[model samples]
Target: MSDQESSTSTSQTEGEVEGELDEEVDTEMEGEGEHDSKHRDSPPLQISSFSSTLRAVIRIKQKYHALKKRRQEAEGDGALTGATGRTSPKIFTFDGTTPIALSVPQKKKRKRRRRVMYPNRGKRRAPPKPARSRAKYCLYLLFAIVFVQVYNAIENLDDHLLRYDLEGLDKTLRREVFGQQGAVEGLLSHLKEYLSTYVHNKPWCCPCTAPAGVGKSHLGRLLAGHFRSVVETLVLQYYVLHHCPQEADALQCARDLSALISEIVERAEEEEKIPLFIFDEAEHMHGEILDVLLQLVSSEQTNEYLNAIYLFLSNLGHSHITKHMLHNSSSTSMAKSGRYSHFVKELTPILRNTLEKLHVLWTEADILPLGLLEKGQVMECFLDEMTREGFYPDHTNIERLAGEIEYYPEVGGHEYSQTGCKQVVAKVNLL
Candidate 1:
């Protein structure tokens, strides 16, 4: 039943019960009145009936209270019909009219909050590094290539130098050829510098000027022999007095000399070799012969003519060289730098002037003067010759042999040998 209809029916039932109780009370009261008229004669029986009536009224009141409690429980159940298993609502009256029901609030199921994770937090980050430049790497590569090229060029130059055997040549010159340290040094400097490379712009011409019997011819022969040993058939030792002795043979001599030089230079160029040409007694060479040599050694010649060494051993400036040596014999300055260099420096122009008067061919030549030999050098030559002849000569015998040779400025303490070492070999043979 609906809550409102049921409550109304309950109220109606309670009113009907109260009306029946009232009717019963009224009937009992009427009976009491009638009994009172009759029971005036019996009072005790009337009193018992009134007590019984009071108990009956009390029982009726208890029953009514029990029914009212049951009705209130039913009303509560009806109010919460759709929403079961909930606690009973508390009753609160408003303005003394109707009760307001307040239900207990259910707690909501709390959703689990997700935890967020952050990476590398609280620390400062470094900036990105820059890359290396391409130009730097390119420059390093260029340096490496240049270094390799320079090293290779040096190796090639050393290879070219090995063919000449310059060390052996220098040793031979120093050992066998004495009293010409300056000449040897100058000659080797030129040779080493020239032979280090195969390319050349002009021929090397060294004109040796000295007096007779002062080892000019010996120096020429030594060079010829050394070069021949190394270069085989490419060395030429030409003697002007021996080859073209007469003026009548001048034309023929010029032609022959030109052909020979042309053949040597052509052959040397083809072989990538430097040829040696020694002209003994160059002062006696005919004008036509000089012209031929001049053209061959000229800087204007073809490339093939530029890789030859020309040695002209001549007595052209013997008087001037001998006079300079004698004049400077007492000077300590000339002795310090070696007499050969001093002669070359002081007399090269003088020799050049003298040669130009005869022929311009010699003006371009490198003048290497041979100074007068000292008495001590002559003595060493004596000892050398004696050793070669299988004679173990003592210092006394060496002095005696050197004493036999003539010296100039007889009264001076520093006398020079007049004939150099020219007569030493003959004298040592006599011993």
Candidate 2:
């Protein structure tokens, strides 16, 4: 066997032996008399190792006194080094003399008149992390952080493979999007087939970009945390709110965002390349930032990353722009390509020409049509979120309310259905 494998095997055997020895030791050393004698007879090196493990075990045992035996066993097994000690496993390290549980100091009882005689007795709070060997403590802390990180990573991997244990946003969609019988099960299953023939076949390779939020953001994020893919999530804070960096803030942010994009792109592994960039709040981006991004997206050097993708999500809302600004061709959704009459109001011929060019260049034939959510769809989405948080909608109550409102004509008039059945529906008298 290879040295590494041999070492691993030895450790495993040692762990098993240590566990058995620990159980025997604990049984023998339950009493104070037996524990002291065991410690005295143990060689110094052995005693030190035992003590090191024992201190941890003692702390764990205290935390899990109800499951004292199990916690001690895990600590003995070296599995309960830290937090897991609430259920620490014990290894049976032994020369076979017997087992011993080391005795720790007991907590003192509080006196009834303590506050009266000594007002500040328990009032003096201890500081964070007691004074200790600075270097050793720091080293221990750093090691601990690394250990926990590795452990959590492994645990996450395990959860991802099992998928039933998937947590967070991706988890919810798994049964729907990726599950065997999920709602979008066919889509995810056939996704591989579709990917073989999927997009970016345009002759103009400048931006092989798909519409942001064309499911890329969700796909990326889900992939990152899942086993089947790399860190697939796109950090798309920019796209969600179309109105980022209002007025004065807009020009500056739009320019600087290129730097942010560059930093993230550089840090991301090439194998996990981002094919889409979801700039959600494009309206807020400085024109310069948008320009730089367009350059990046269009570059041949940028698209080789097989493991990564770029997504830009934007609300595509025009609520904050001026009337003249809105008239610019770029202001309309890409899905709407026909020239609007209102677009002729631009004061600056240069800006107008630039906007027209960009609008045409960006939206040409490739734009995905907007698929606005139906009222029921929006309600279902809200209900799903609430249900996840333990707040289910009362269908009977809502139906009753709807019926009562419909019975009263002045509530919302004949056109009530088009306006929706929200709370204020009953108060309208615009007629």
Candidate 3:
């Protein structure tokens, strides 16, 4: 019971302490509430002083900017006055204070634009061409073919029978014959006439007859040399008596002659050139061969492009010609006549008869007898031969040789050249 009483006293003391602590706390709370209320009741502290200060700062900044602008303007004016020697305007601030200078902003420079380059930009490609026409292609092909054929023909020209060894003929003429000016001139005139006849579209023939070694072949050569430019080919075919094989009969001879004539005619047509065919030692040709040659020349096929000269050199009927010359020497009437013209007139009939007998189709006008070499001509020929043989004989030796050469009237008659100037060189050599 004492313990319970003690417990109650302690509890009562504890409550009183608690109540006192509560009261103190209430007072503290009231004081704090009053303070807070006073603080809340009063108007919020105004920031007007700070706001006024900011305003002053802003005004100062504006003034500073104006001063700086004015100072810059004054400096610029001073610089202008110093440079130009002129009076500068005064720059002053509105507030009348010393101006402050500020840095001026610099303008930026612009960059230059560069040209851009691309690979192959400047190159231009050509447009594709149109197709060629068939006609043009065909024409080109034809031309190519023709050109090839012509080139081949020209390359093979040496293989043709019409082609001859001109160098050999030239050598022979230079070595074997000399000094027959009259004969050469007469032959040239005949050739010119033949060319004129062809130009006039007339068929012509030249039949030259003379004794052996009387410059008949030589005259033909001269004619060839003169007309080389005019004639495409100058063919000389020699018919050597007893030299040709026995098997070369009349038919073989005709065929050979025909082939040669055909070649010449073909060449003439193809080359567009006149041809001259010389038959040397023509008297050795068979009668049948002559007939074939005549037929070939006169044929319509040949005559179309056969603007050619057929020169036949022969020894036939030379005796008759010489006899006539001898007769002219004896008879005053014949002597009064022109020798060549009269001889031509007289010899034509004999040539006609002889050729007709031989079955040749030739006319009297075709025959032209070659002139015989005179004594003077023989002497000149001897001198020429001596010179050719590397001998330089004086005038006395020349006169001696000339006197030593014998002349015979019976051989060709009328002091005709019996040896036909061929014996002169041999006789001079003997001397």
Candidate 4:
């Protein structure tokens, strides 16, 4: 009976140990279930975990693409191929089940190609040029400037005064100065003597008095042409002292005359050329201007070079000269005895007196009287003019032209035309 009772106690102790182990297992299973239920009930915790895992996957993909791109660029090929001839490994997510293809960034194409080789590459260029070369360039530029200036000076030196044809003077005289042969020859002789004095450096002044259309200006121009090399003609009527409407007042005219005289004096001094100042229509000039002219011509200092000639042309003493001729030539015998010369001598003092009364600066010695032209001389002039103009007129035409010309007793009766030789050419044109 003792042995049976020990065996029964051992069996009871084994049963009790098994029951405690079962209870511990049941409690652990309940705690695991509660943890799983809390995880399911809170969605924020699950989302946070999933987001963190997704971010980790994205980061891993970026790293893989960067590495692949670098390798491909180094190998000069696509991301799938490597420099070592091996394919690039594919990337995966954390689960290793989902494959991830990280796209490698492409390189932009270059607009311009870079040169791989150059002829003078890796070598320094030549040193700066020498100063001697720069100086030579400067000298060339200076020489060009000097050459241009010398060329301009040569051009200026070629300048000359404008003058009329001298060869036509004889033709003009034969055609125009018909019956005034004695008067013209006498005047020309006086001019020759005057020019001789001028050549000896003696200044001269002359006043030529004549009726209108008696060829005073024409004669003056002929004389000017004769001595063109020494004479510079200034026609007052055409120049600053003209009778145009735009002429300045008397005072201004005097000023202009002064300026012109000063310029002429300076030019004469510099160029050694004589100035023949011809005052045409002297009657139109104011007495003040005439006085200024007289002062200019009379001044010894102004005419120091004897390079001036003042020739005053006017009709101022025409009537007096005509009357003197008429009174002295009352008879044909008296007229043929060179009575005009005597009359001129007689008229000098009278002209001086008249000029003095008029406050004129000129004296009787300056008077060079031009008389009326003859009818025969007028006919000769008309015929000469017709020949010069290429016209062959018949005797009837010549007679008609002669009849058209009017004669005035005041101008030496039939010896001179009323308009002198001025209208002779025009009347011939009408025929």
Candidate 5:
């Protein structure tokens, strides 16, 4: 049963046993004294209670021994280490009286039992963490969407650029009727930005010298494609005169120039629009044709009526032309004659003044020593193109290729290393 009920029953049993023992002791003493002849007038009921007590004395002794053994065994296991400190409880009388008041085991007062409130004490004002629920997930999703949009925009822009390049090639072919598209594109890309920016301000000109097979002509074709509709082409290959096989060759060259100019003049007359003239390999212009072309530019019809754009392309270096004998002797006639009549730098005197008046732009390497694609731009282009192909580009590889392209066969010229596209393909495979 429960501890409290068991304790009460045990206490009652012990009291009954002790009371019977006391009575037995008294009866024995009385019996011995009465048998001799003294102390006879004791109550019969007292005698009966005394006799019953004596009979129960043996049972009381046995119960005491049983309880003591049980208590000692319990103590051996450390279970009886209660507050009493006694190995066994003392037996006492019944009738709600103690034979000796064995003091009720004092409950040890544990310093007013200060119950510590450990968990709940510091809980009141702690600021709430994670103020935005599921915010990390939202942030990640937003970033993912932004990244995707940016990637798409870049991809579309690149496609636009490549298509523009191809179109430029076609235009170059249509106008020059000579040269390949790739080299032309390479050349034209350099001047495109400046041309668009200064369309009204400057006459376009890019004078780059290249070996015959290096594709300067092709680059010119690229320009023709680039200018497709924005600027009309009126090309006059003046050098054809120097190598003309017959009189008809000169006549045909004139016809070509006339046809080209006539087409533009007709358009301007019809649409009231100005035209742009492209003179590729302008250095080839000989004495007679040079004078004709100069006359064309100087004419009010070309300058005011047509509102022309003159773009002179050539491979002849400006320094060489100023110092060379060929351009000086027969190409031009100085306005003011002298007795000595020295053949000065005729191309400069002729071109500088004419081009300034018409705002013809000569794409001068002297002006842009650096290519359009700077080192940083090249690196970015490389990484971006490579990454799109699912390859991680190595900076070391790019640097090596850039170094290879820093010098071309020409003394001061640098060729683009697109021929090394194969090498880039191989490196990307390694990644």
Candidate 6:
């Protein structure tokens, strides 16, 4: 039995050992299969020396340089073709499964050229700015045209006064009138302003107020004569003392005066001329005559009356004028300096006020007060009279004739003549 047991044990041990051996073989085979599988899944290990690695690196650099060179050449060709207006084909390369654009080369940095400044660079005119719009130029031209037209219109407004030879009249007044410089200038200035234009809001009404023998009547005669010479038919020299004296019927005189003025104005209007009406010794005009004259000179009159110039030579404010002239005689220096305008300005209101007390007509009149004549002006008057009378004006005789004329301020040296140049013609004739 023991022997049989021994044999079974031995057989079992042997079978077990065989089985273990087979299991070891199977594990070795499985490890070998796994090693094959890992070798297949992973990349193979490479062994290299430094020199071989450097050589491989050089070859890779060479390949990369070759690709960059090809890309640059392709880009240059594309640029050249693009400049010629030709379409360029894209160059692409495949690395395994991915494609790369090799025609698009890395941009090279451009070399900048040094700037060269020429001496005349700043002096060169910049391109001309675009021309101003034609509408702007047209606007400027229109403005200039409007300005010229307005200027011409303003100048033409004074043509009427110039046409009447006002400069010549001014020269005559200055040359003929003596010691009445203020009066003459005031009268001329007003006339020039009034006659500068044909259209007026009212007629030109001037009152010459002065004492007797102060050239009031002479001034009126000079004006009347000038107007008669220029416009003989249009000039009316009406003498209140002669034409319609105090004894005449006032109403009848008024009627005749109105009819005469109407006829003269109508005729002058037809001729396109301004009429002149000189009322001599207006202080003697009857109330009825004054009323008619007032109506003619009133601003309420018809348009025809506005085209006429009316002058009233009177002694209405003679007392006030004489007193003012005497008081201002010492200040003749202002008159000598050609600044006697203020004297007339100062005396105008006085004369107007004095005359207005008699009639409101004077309120509308431009007052021209005749100041006292200087001794020198009286001498000039004498010389002028002598010359007009066809006699040689000797200065000695002129001085002698001027000496006979009474002067104001009897105590002091004679400065102003008492009677101005009114009596100069008579005195010269006596001489």
lDDT of 5 by residue, 184-227 (tens): 33345544433232213323333444323233444445545455
Q: Please write out the lDDT profile of model 4 over residues 269-340, one tens digit for every residue.
A: 675555667677777777568767766665455354355667777787788866665554443322222655
In candidate 2, what are the lDDT values of residues 1-431, reduced to their tens digit? 23553355446655665576567556644644465667678655455666766785676455445444564575566543522322224464554334446779999997667454444876975658977777998999999999999999777546433432223433445532211122123223322322232133221211112122223234444533442333344333354244444556655666566666666656544433332344443334455565555555553544332222343333232121122332332423212223222221222343334334654334321221122212333233334434555644566533443343322122211111222223222322211
Query: Model 1 RMSD to the real structure?
Result: 22.3
Best lDDT goes to which candidate? 1
What lDDT score belongs to each candidate, Candidate 1 first?
0.80, 0.39, 0.60, 0.60, 0.45, 0.74
Error of 6 at 376 (Å): 2.6
Per-residue lDDT of candidate 1, residues 1-431 (tens digit): 34664465556655655676577667766876786778778746656677876776676566656655665676467557832222234354454344546678999999989987554777756767899799999999999999999999999999998888888888987787767777878888888898898889998998888877768898888888888888888999999999999999999999998999899888898899999999999888889998888889998899989989999998897888888777666644232336556667888888889878988887777888877777788887887788888999799999988888888983235778888898988888787
Q: Model 4: number of clashes?
A: 1
Summarize candidate 6's per-residue lDDT along 1-431 as a digit string, tens digits. Answer: 13453355445544554565556556755865676588677676455434564675566556556654655565467446743112233243343334434676779999998998665855875676896677998999999999999999888876666667778887887777776666677788888888777777788888887777767787778888777777779999998888876555889989988999999999988877899999998888888987888888888888888899999888787788677766655533433426467777687787777788998788877787766667887787777778889999789878888888787764234376677777776776675
Error of 5 at 34 (Å): 99
**lDDT assessment of candidate 1:** 0.80
- Among residues 3 or more apart in sequence or in different chains, the pairs in candidate 1 whose N, CA or C atoms overlap within 3 Å are none
Cα deviation of 190, candidate 5, in Å = 16
Ranking by TM-score: 1, 6, 4, 3, 2, 5
TM-score per model over all chains: 0.68, 0.33, 0.51, 0.52, 0.30, 0.67
* Top TM-score prediction, candidate number: 1
Clashes per prediction?
A: 0, 56, 0, 1, 17, 0
RMSD of candidate 5 to true structure, Å: 26.4
- lDDT tens digits, residues 1-431, model 3? 23453355445544554565556556655865675587687777468745764675566556556654655575467446743112233353455344446769988887977977555867866678998788998999999999999887766553332333443444444455553433444544564444433332434576777766677766666656645644546454545454343545778767876776777777766665567776777767766776676675663644544576677788777777666666555322221225556556767787678766765556533677765555656777777778878788667787677667566554333454566676666776775
